[model samples]
Target: MNIGLFFVPFFEVMRMLFAYTTEKQLVNARNATTGTQYYCPDCGSLLIRKAGSLLIPHFAHSAKEICHGMSEGETIEHLNLKQMFYQWGQQTDQQWQLETPLNDLAQRPDLLNRKLAVEIQCSSLKSTRLAERIKGYSQNGYQDWWLLGVKLRPNKKFTSLQKQFCSFSKDKGVHVWGIKKDEISLFYHIYQQDQHYQYSKKIWPSYSVPITTILNTNLSELPPKIILSKQSVLAEKRRLAKRLSCSEPKVMKVQTYLYLQRRHLLYLSEWIYFPSRYSFFYQEDLLIFRLLFQQEAKNADTIFKKFLYYRETMQRKWIFHRIEEREILERLYLEAIFCQRKAKIL
Candidate 1:
């Protein structure tokens, strides 16, 4: 239900620090006696205790052995975060397993407790792989929580991969969590304006805050209302007018389509230019959607059916898989109604 972030330095020479004994006893390389033997929890291979001034005390496989528990060339930041979470879990008296392998799911999450699987992603992951892992968790009745690293942090504009990491909740709307040193932050109420996104954030001490409390915290506030003033609408119109004069291909395509319907880009219904907070979820042009809806401007059912068609046809791709279609349709319908009411006053 919530995502998180963390920042730390990447170590070129890395393995895993957390390992288990033949008898399944958990061991940290830092506390292990030198020359004593430790084995990988997942693969049961002998592990070498690694320690140095620059490196965090950890464990490494004796050789390049294949094991899900050990990530090759793992970053020091990743290991530190795992230790922080593991220690926090212990302090909070929560049963947390570090680098635990889920044999049933054919995966090893950074941390696992009950039905929750936490993945601390510090490196780039392909979109297909991300989707597959998420699906694997869902199919096996486990909840997947992804915590982003510094390299994958969201910006004013989101990349496709960043959007894929987002999760949704009624309290926070679209949200993510980021961790930096001892502080953990929740970025919520994510909305879009034109090409960029806007969001609000709250931070807490990572170790001091109870994990359950942070996960369960609710703002209980409504998502920000979508308000388009005349000035704002005029601003968009002027920008579009400028682009049209320069004959930009994408802008011209929309202009030509409007021309076919005897509509001009700058002179059309003001409602068509109104931006939706959920616009980021849409891949099809919102402007074109509004234009089509206006052309059918008879009743709610007609508009709803048209919207349903778009959903089925994949004209709009919902990045957050957890969001229900009904919520999106209902909110957009209400937004259109409000725009219509405003248009009447104008």
Candidate 2:
């Protein structure tokens, strides 16, 4: 089994379990003879195969130039998780490859099986790079699965960067994967309640659940939907009112905008406060956007078109990679219309 590379203490260098010999034949460090010369598959430089009772068999770069294909470094947790995945694949007799390089895409996924490319993210990454890598995989006919490392796990809210990893599915809604020790956590049914976001979590022992089963979870296995209680909405409304009374800079800005449109901040359309999980990704202020939609849209028939217009004219920032912009906007519009009608009845 190929273990790829892991951070080694000696000389503070990464030692890969796979290498190539002078004949250009790939060799696993466990099988390669110590006296035989091995070369880095990526850099094509001489490699020193290290083996001992204290250390796992691996090959380290003979020189200082690190492989450009990998990240600057891998955390111990990251490497261990990768190893665990490899072991699980072996146990299940699945054809999984580690650090498979997609030469055409110029990207190397942590693990690959057919069209599925799994990326393990253990540390903070620039959003632009994340977007670029995702696009690259998608364009090259591969599905990218990002599993967040322990440090990148969401708490109260997902950071803008973490939001980039989220993918939408009809069954799971907006969801992301995180590694919690030896368990895999699925944070699904993520929805915005009021000013805060909530999600239902499911956990499975790393080897207990098959990777395919997790990836192919369908509506039949859907988690229960999150309910936004009236009390939460009321509390959020009170918070908004308090902020306005205190003249908070951000809240005052929204008030000024509403004033220009001849709309009272305290008496905006009820849809402006409707909860939506998808709309949380919108760059524009959610309440302001809802108010504008309520004002400009004639009825439900025109809501979607009007939203597309606003999205184009205002140039909203799109961060969710897998979810379509129209899908999110349309869902928000319908949810708003429903909320508006519900308000009228109450």
What TM-score, over all chains together, does every model reach?
0.80, 0.81
Provide the overall lDDT of each model, using Cα atoms, as 2-decimal numbers. Answer: 0.72, 0.71
User: Model 1's lDDT to the true fold?
Assistant: 0.72
List clash counts for every candidate, in order: 6, 0
Instruction: Put down candidate 1 lDDT per residue, 321-341, tens digits, no spaces.
Output: 555666776666676777777
| TM-score, predicted candidate 1 vs. hidden true structure | 0.80
Score residue 283 of candidate 2 by CA lDDT.
27
TM-score of 2: 0.81
Residue 296 of model 1, lDDT score:
73
